[model samples]
Target: MPTLVKRLLAALVIFLLLVVINQYMSKEGLFGFGVPSYYARLIVLAGINIILAVSLNLITGFTGQFSIGHAGFMAVGAYSSAYLTVYYAQAWERSLGGIVGGSLAHALIFLLAILVGAIVAALAGLIVGIPSLRLRGDYLAIVTLGFAEIIRIVILNIDSVGGATGFTVPGYANFLWVYAFAIITIVIVYNIVHSDAGRALVSIREDELAAEAMGINTTRYKVLAFVISSALAGMAGVLAGHYLSFLSTNDFQFIRSFEIIIMIVLGGMGSLTGAILGAIIITFLPELLRTLGPRLESLLSSIFGADNIPASVHTFLLQLANYRLVIFAALLILIMLTRPQGILGTREFGLSWLKRARRRPEGDKPVGTGGVSIAEQEPPSAIDRAKEVKNQ
Candidate 1:
C-alpha cells in the first residue's frame, strides 16, 4: 500500500477511537459507575499539555534550541485572552444582554480573544528569541529561565489584571473548544515539521555551522520556529485559563515550564506522537497514584496489623499529596538514567513500528533473507570445480 493511504487509514482509526471514547463518556456512566468531573478536567489538561509539548518540540527538539521559558509565553496568552474575554464579555453583556444575544457576535468575541493570545505570545517569543537565540547551550537556557521569572514578576505587579489575588475569567471552555484547538495545534505543527522549512530547522539541529555554510539562513528559521512554538503555548494557556475560569501569576511560574520540558523529554523530544503520549501519561499518572493511596494504606495496615501501624503512617500517606513534585522529579531522573532517548525515542509512533506492523503483507518473506529465485542461481565456476578436485 502507498504511504499516504496507510497514513490516512491510521488517522481514521485514531479518529474513530476518539469518537467512541467521547461517546462513551457522554453516556450514562462507565461500568455502572459515574465518572467524576475531575477526570474530565484531567482529559482537558492532557490535551493542553499535549499542545505545549508538541509545540515546544518544534523549537527545542527539531530546531535544536534550548528554551526554558515556555510558560512565560503561556502567561502572555492567558492574561491577554483573559483580559479580552472578561472586559469584552462584560461590555457585550451590558449592551446586548449576554453571549446569546447573537451567536455570531459571541463567536467573534471568542475568536478575537484567541487571536490576541496568539499574537501576544508570538511577540513575546520574538522579543526573547532576538537576543537569546544568539546564545547556545546553558547560556540560552539561563536566559530563557530568567525571562520566565521576569514575566511572572511583571504579572504579579499588574494591578488592573488582578495583581496578587488573581483574576476570575468567565467559564467559556468545553470539550469542543479544548479538543478542537488541540487538533488545530497538532495539525499545524505536523505540516510545518514536514515542510521545507522543517528541513531547514532539522539542518540547524544537525549542525548550525553546516546549515549556515549551506546558505540555509539558520537564524531566520530559528526565530520562526520559536515564534510558532510560543504562539501555540499561548493558545494552550488560553484554553487552560478559560476552562478553569481563573488566572493567577503563580499558575504560569517556572515550575510549570519545567513540567512541560519534562513531558517533552520523557516523550521523545522530536516526536509528535510521543509528545501526545507523554502528555496523557504524565497527566493521568498522578491521578492514578492518588487513587492508589487508600489501597496502599490498607495493604500496609493489613501486613503490619492495625495495632502495629502507627498513626504517622496515615499522616505520611496524606503528605504524599504534597510530594507530587518530588515524585515527578524522581520519575524524570529515572527515565533519564534508564532511557535518555525517551519513551518513544526521537521516532514517532506512526512513523516506524506502527506503520511497519500495519503495512506488512501476511505471507511475505522476512525482510532481509534474500529469497533468490532458482533461475537466478548459478552453478560453480570451472576454477571452483578445479580447486575442489585439487583438494580431494
Candidate 2:
C-alpha cells in the first residue's frame, strides 16, 4: 500500500480507538467499564499541556527563541473563541444543525472557534515577534513577559469577557477533542522540525549572525515559528476554556507560563518526546504528591506491622500531604540539579535512536568482506608493490 494510504488507515484506527476511549470516559460507562472523573480530568489536562509544551518547543527549543508569553496568547484564544461560542454558536449551530445533525453542528462551531482563536493568537505572536525577536536572550524574554502582563491587564479591563468575575463558556471540548488537537500539534511541530524550514530555525538558534550571513532569513523563520507557536497555544486555550466551562484571567498568569517552561526544561529542550514526557510529569506530579503520604504509610504498614508503627512517624506521614507543594518544588529542584540538560537533551525516543545505538563503528570492520577496514589495513610490502608494477 502507498504510504499515504497506510497513514490514513492508521489515523482511522486511532480515531476509532479514541472514540471507544471517549465513551469509556463518559458518565455512562462503555459496557460498565469507565475511568474515574479524577483520572479523566488529569488525562485531558495533560493533553492540553502537551499541546502547549510541544507548540512552545517549536519556537523556544527548535527555533531558539525565548518566549515567556504563551499564556497571554492562550488567553487571547480562549476569550475570542468563548465570545463567539457564547453569542453566536447557538445560532450557527441551529442553522447548521438542519443540514448536518446537531452533534456535527456543535463540533463545527467549536472548530470555527478554534480557527478564530488560532488566527487571533497568531496575529498577537506576529505583532510581538517582529519587534521583540530582534533582541536576543534576556531582552527577548523581558519583552515577551511584559507583553503577557499587558495582555492580562487588558483582558481584566474588558468587561465583555467578565473581567474579574470570569467568563463561563459551553463545554464543547472533551477528551477526544483535546487529544485530537494535541496530536495535531505534535505532528505539525514534528514535521516542521524535520523540514528545510526547521533547519533554518535550528540554524538561527545555533547562531543568528551566521544564519543571517548565510541568507537564511533568520527573522522570518523566527517570526514564523513564534506565530505558529502562538496559534497552537491559542488552540489549547480554546479547548481548556470549553473543557472547564470557564475562563479566568488569573489562570493565564505569568506563573502559568513558567510552569510550561518548566515542563520543556525538565523534559529536555529541543526534544519533542521530551516535551511530551515533561508535560505529563508536570501534570501528574502534584496530584501524586497529594497522595504520597497515604501511600507511604500504607507501604510502611505492610512492611512493618501496623501495630509496630510509631505514632510520631504516622503523624509525620499524614502531615506530609500539607507540604506537597514544597515537596514538589524540591523534587523538581533535585531533578534539575542532577540532570540539567534534562532527561533527554536534544535527543528523541524512538526506533531510530535504538538503531543508532546498535550501529557499528566505520573502522571496526572491513568495507565489504571480513577483512580489515580501509583505515586499519596494513601497508603493502616491497614485494607487493613490485608485483603490482609488473602486472601493470
Candidate 3:
C-alpha cells in the first residue's frame, strides 16, 4: 500500500478511537458505558505520563544518553503555559473578539499557549543540550540534574507567578485534549524512531564512535534527540498544568523526573509499547495501593475473627498508606531481578502483529496417498517436505 494511504488509514483509526474515548468520558455515560470521573482523571494522567516516558526513551534508550531533568522541562512548559492562559488570557480573548469566542476561543488559546510553552522549553533544551552534549556518562547526568535544580530555583523565586506559593492555572484541558496531544506525541516519536533520522539515532546508540567514523554527525543528532525529548516532556507538562489547574515547582521536583525514568526503564527502554505500559502502571499503582490497606484490614479481620484482632495490628494495617513507596520500590526491584531488559525490552507491537495472523478455510483437510481423510497432518514447511522426501 502507498504510504499516504496507510497514513490516512491510521489517522482514521485514531480519530475513531478518540471519539469513543471522548464518549466514554461523558458524565452521563456513553450508551451506558462510561468511566467514573476520578478514573477518567487517572486515565488522563496516564496519557501524560506515557508522553513523558516515550519522550525520555528517545534520548536515553534510542540515543544512549542519560538525562534526569525531564521534570525541569515539564516545569518550564507548565509555568509558561499557565502564565499565558491564566494571566494574559483576557488580553488574547479580547483580541480575538468576533474572530472566535466562547469555548472555541478557549480551545484555540489553550493550544496556542501550549505551543508557545513547548517552544520556550525546547529553547531551554537547546541551551542545555549544546553545552552538556560534550560530556558523557556520569558527567552528562550530573549536568542535566543540575539544570533541573536551577530551573526549580529560578521558578521558585519568580514572585509574580506566586514564588514559593505556587500558581493556579486555568483548567481548559479535557480528556479529549489530553488524548489528542498524547496521540500526537506517540505518532511523532514513533515516526522519528522508524525514520532515517531514527536510524541515525540508533546508530549513535549502538556505537557513537563507529557512527561518527561512518560520516554521521553524532553531536548534532544527540542534541536533536535531546531537544525533541525535552520538548515532548514540556508538552506533557502543559497538559498536566491545564488538567490539574495548578502548578508548583515542587510538583516538578527531581523525584518526579525519577518516576518518569522508572516508568520507561521498567516498561523496557527503546520499546514504545513498554514505555506506555510502564506509564499506566506507575500512574495507577499508587491509586491501587491506597485501597490495599483497607482491603488487608478487612481480609485479616475475616480470617482471624474481628473480635480477636488486636488494636495494634489494626493500627498497623491502617498505616499501610505510608508504606506504598516501599512496596512500589520492592516491585521495581523484583522486576529488575527477573527481567533486566525491562518489561518488553526493545520489541514493538506494531504492524507485524497483523502480518502474523492466519486465516485457514473452513473444512480444509489433508488427504493420504490412498485418498482417505487424514485427521492430522504435519504443517506445511520446507523442513517438513524435506523430511517426507528423506523418508520416501
Itemize residue pairs with steric clashes in candidate 2.
none
Q: Which stretches of candidate 3 lie above 4 Å from their native place?
A: 1-6, 26-28, 31-33, 94-97, 298-313, 354-392
Selected candidate, larger lDDT, 2 vs 3:
2
lDDT, candidate 1, equals 0.84
Query: Which candidate, 2 or 3, would have the higher TM-score against the true structure?
Result: 2
In order of appearance, the predictions have TM-scores of 0.80, 0.93, 0.85
| Superposed Cα RMSD, model 3 | 6.6
Error of 3 at 340 (Å): 1.4
Which predicted model would earn the best lDDT?
2
- Candidate 1: tens digits of C-alpha lDDT, residues 27-94: 36545654467787788789889889999999998998989999999999999999988877667655
The candidate that achieves the highest TM-score relative to the unseen native structure: 2
Worst ten-residue run, lDDT, model 2?
A: 364-373
Order by TM-score, highest first? 2, 3, 1
What's the lDDT for all of these models? 0.84, 0.94, 0.89
Which model is ahead, 1 or 2, in terms of TM-score? 2
Model 3, global lDDT: 0.89
